[model samples]
Target: MTVFLIWSCSGKNASEISNETLLIVKKIEKINVLMGSAVGSSGHKPNQYENFEELKKNASKQELITLTNHSNGVVRCYSFWALALSENIDLFSIIKDHINDDTQVKTQFGCSGSTEKVGDFFINLVNPKDEDSDITKLTPDEFNKLDSLLIHKENNLYARYDAIANAVPTAYLYSKVREMVVKHNNQNALITLSKYKNPHDIELILKNRDPDEDGESGYFYTYKAIQNFPDPIFLPFLEKKLNETLDNDRYDGEWLQLYMAIASYKNQKSLELLTIPFTKVKHQDIKKYHIKFVYEAIIVNKSKLYDDLLWKIWQDENIITQEGFEYLLQLNKTKTLELSKKELNSNYQIKNTNTIPKINQSMFSQNLEENMLNFVLLNDKVFAYNVINDKIINTNVNDFEMYCSKILELKDPSFTEILFKRLKNEDNPHVYLQIVETLISFKDESINKRILETRKKNKNMNQDWGSEALDEILKKNKIK
Candidate 1:
């Protein structure tokens, strides 16, 4: 078979290139482009190779052999695997040579020590001897080879983790993994142990509870291990740490770990332990630290016992700030929204009128701005237009619309300047029209004059939508 490589010739069209040449050129280009990207991250673009298996299916034996000698290691590795998958047993010698070659390949998990990974990939392609023999059923020799690879510190971390994690959960493998957990305090090793859930291994994990050499606390690993194992024995240890930390003045980071561990327990006792501090603690600072974990515990357990407690906390004016309100809304949105509506209405006057009433406009404006600021600051769910600051403080479209609705309902002349500024800058014709309608409802002469001027200027530039909307508004009010 002939191989085709794309060259830098100008004025070439698709019709001029042979179908076979185009396919080969595309495959080679893909291999070259993808080989340099870092694995296991966003840099690895998989869509480029979506048709890789299809291309492999159409590859000739000669083409596969030629690819094995390609400069890009990934291309070579893939070509060898494709040949192996097609059951081309006659090419085993050539494949082995490629596998034993010193050329390094950057794989999905980064660079392998040599072509050793391709050899592993070849092993994966071979079927098991029996129905019960899975990929994990490796011979003693194969297991040892993988174990050596796993223990080699210079190997890629993901490669090492994958080797042990995918291996059969044998006694020897479990013991080696436990040693890795203790020595390296690796999160992956601990997770691998959790897969086995060996009782003796739990004690080993507990013994090596200190932070790793990298200063990353082992509590996360412990939390994950307990989640997998679900042993009751660790509860007392977790509770003791929680109590000790709460007693101390300094709220070290370890307390968070302890709370997380206790939450992971997902037991009645753990729920009670989490709830007691949230309910009994009157100190605002202490409650603040523990409330997040308490919320997590409640959500994790799905316990109805904390419903009233959460509601009580939400109603507490001293404690229910923007963050707390948002948390409450997340937990029980229907109830919180109902409560919020009532609270908001009682705190501020909301009127729906077409005309601004002549009732102390200065005092009403001041009160409205102050109330709007308070509402915006206290409730994370509400958006506010700051009249003095001349900015929309929040980006939520629904919240902004609600604030605009309130301004229109009250027919507040104080918001005329900011609203006009926003209307002039807004590119969306529909939203600009709505703002014009709201402005017209205010019935302020100065605002009407400004709108008329803006409409005339827009008309001159052939940007006549604003002028047309303002004309409709003036006609509706029966103004000349």
Candidate 2:
């Protein structure tokens, strides 16, 4: 049957297009050039893809369908998309034949882009609940039929997984989904199977998983599936994998998922497994990227079991000190403040490096800059004034502008003199302006006299905004 279809269509081969087909082919090629390297949303470049609309309006439905099998993957996708959106023909009928078409195309939706197989693209176009796309919506019956088409073992692997995931829970769908997962070693399909939370499915994933035979891809999806359906039954496997990664230093991009999956178990052993990287892996880059997952997992566990580990990380000055500090801040307030005071009194030197470890931003209510200030302030208003004074007077401290801005946010009068002292000696026009602005924010009468004295003393300073700011302060205070 396949040979017959190929032989019959060989006469009107894409290589030798008739005059009528030539125009549609040229328009399709233009859509490709205008879209550049990736197919985007219909509105991504409306003008560029207007060619598709032109073909939809003037070209016969057969013309568009014929182009679905064109030599170019882009042509095939756009042609199918045109048919799917037009609604003059049944999209499922057209898409059913192409469920196994594995030609890949680059697609962009908003800021994200990925290379997707053409068959998956067809499936996604009519996937229910995607109101944002231009494709026509399908009836529930049609959707079930579409998913049934994809659940066939012969279909594209991703499409099969996605269909099994979305299809109604039925004996056939479950059987097909399980068959693909167990028999074919389709680990990605395991993500869908694990969603059912079946013990048998979990055992299948565990028994079928041989990281040695499948390497890290199998482990990656297995970890993802386990993350979706976390169970204590898989704890030993996760622990062994965690140790293997730590001991071999072989974190081939599965560190975050693996760490969090183990962390999901949330037992003393899991906590110990998550902490292994801090002491075991000597690679700084890996630690920098993945330490937050470990920190987040431990903090969310809310167990003091890891307090010793957090304190150890805090005491040892390393790349992840901020993570340790913030973790302690969340889990142990008294200890966090004590550590903050110790660091403040020592005026700890923060090493300026290209990469700065941030407090896991989502976990905190405050943004990164405010959270950095809290690292010093400890959220204690009384202690913040003293720390601000100490940091401002040091002058050698890094990130001075950031510290100065915090003083403005605080709007306290005690910082006026400290800022004034810096202002009197500070020659950097930018820093001088920040100090003046911070002092002005204090709205204290004492700053008026101090400003007048400083302005008079520094009349020779070459600051563009220097005199203007001082004059504004004088005018605002009505001080001549």
Candidate 3:
């Protein structure tokens, strides 16, 4: 047991190190080696939860704070988690200094593992709603200083806003932040100022909008602020900027936000402007997605004009098949059934697997038989099952997993027994898991027995992520 001590007592008369700090240092070392940042049991590293539980039980606040600055990024992250769990700790004071700490830490949630910065990890840990949220525990001084601390980095803007943007009605804080915004032209500060909803700040926000920053950094907060404090006065500016983004053929997350802000106005003309991209956008990928957003906006507004436009686009096959089918089903049953059969029969060879097939029933009725009997008559059990089986056998298709997921959504009982038998044909863990899920959803009596039999034959399935997720899903559903 390496007794790593926090104190440096070299002199002969120096006091001995306390047992509390000594124990904390040892636990921190253990956590550094054995623990990864994870919440659930499915993907947790060995002893990850135990190490955190030990720290939560025995760690002194000062000792945890000392370890939070440790040279190791993972150590800092775990220590921060333990410290934030304390109910009485001033959450903002503890986190304010490390707001820009960019040390990356490996994290696991469920079956996925990802690498994220320590600062981002810390914010997410305390930012969720509940007793431990940072918002519920901030002090007056901490709240006042939040505006200043947030302006230091563009990356930290949204998080900093969440921590302190609760409309505390602090004139001094607002004025101080407004002056800082004017002097530095910080685009991030716009979100914080948006809570005030002052008309004077609108021009300031617009003046700071950088079209060059469209796809990169600052635009998310700008559009988010406009969405939060929406006004028709900002409409012309949003329209002009959105048109510029479209004309330049720039596509990104920010471009989505520009269109979303235009949609928020709920004006017929603004909604019609959104549909213009569907007709003219050159990229099919971009056009498909933007048209979906327009459809959603139209549904929200319940506008018949744009609804008819979607029907026209779907009939032309200008949009994704799923979106086209959704529009077609609303007004024309015969056409929708014809299109569904056409899509199911379309030859999906491995050579054409550039992208996963986009048809889904998640947006439509769960049972195809009830809604489209004519389509499901020949297509079900015989046609659709054969289509899936052919795609599954051709492992070179690369999108067999999507087909399996789509089958799960179809929820047809005819595919259940066949899927159980054909499960062995798929070697990909992701595809295998989807088949298992679809089988379980059927609630067939022999699922557990079949699963055990298959596992007995293929022992290596236990070693794969597919098997691990399979165990978790079965346990979660209370299936044997």
Best lDDT goes to which candidate? 2
By summed lDDT, the worst window of 10 consecutive residues in model 1 runs over: 6-15
lDDT of 3 by residue, 210-316 (tens): 54563444566677678667787877777676666554444565666666666666667676677677666766666666666665545444445555666555444
What number of backbone clashes does candidate 1 have, counting pairs of residues 3 or more apart or in separate chains? 0
Alpha-carbon lDDT of model 2: 0.65
Cα distance off (Å), candidate 1, residue 79: 6.9
Query: All models: lDDT?
Result: 0.54, 0.65, 0.60
Lowest lDDT 10-residue stretch of candidate 2: 1-10
Error of 1 at 325 (Å): 11
Q: Residue by residue across 1-480, what tens digits does model 1's lDDT show? A: 443542321223112333563465456556543332234445563543543564466766666665555555556556665565564344445533433344444444334222345444444443233243322234446445644555543344344665655555666667777777777776677867877877777686566554653333446566656656667887876675556545444344544556666766666787677766655555667666676556554454444555565565545422344544545655654455444544544443333333321212232233333333444434332333343223333223434554565677666677787777665556555556666677778877777777666655543312567556656767887655
Estimated TM-score per prediction? 0.44, 0.58, 0.53
Root-mean-square deviation of Cα positions for candidate 2 versus the true structure, in angstroms? 9.3
Which residue segments of model 2 deviate by more than 4 Å?
1-25, 30-72, 79-98, 106-115, 122-149, 162-172, 195-203, 210-218, 226-239, 271-293, 296-332, 336-379, 386-408, 411-480
RMSD of each: 13.9, 9.3, 10.0
Q: Between prediction 2 and prediction 3, which has the larger lDDT?
A: 2
Better of 1 and 3 by TM-score: 3
Give the candidate order by descending TM-score.
Answer: 2, 3, 1
Pairs of residues clashing in candidate 2: none
Clashes of each: 0, 0, 0
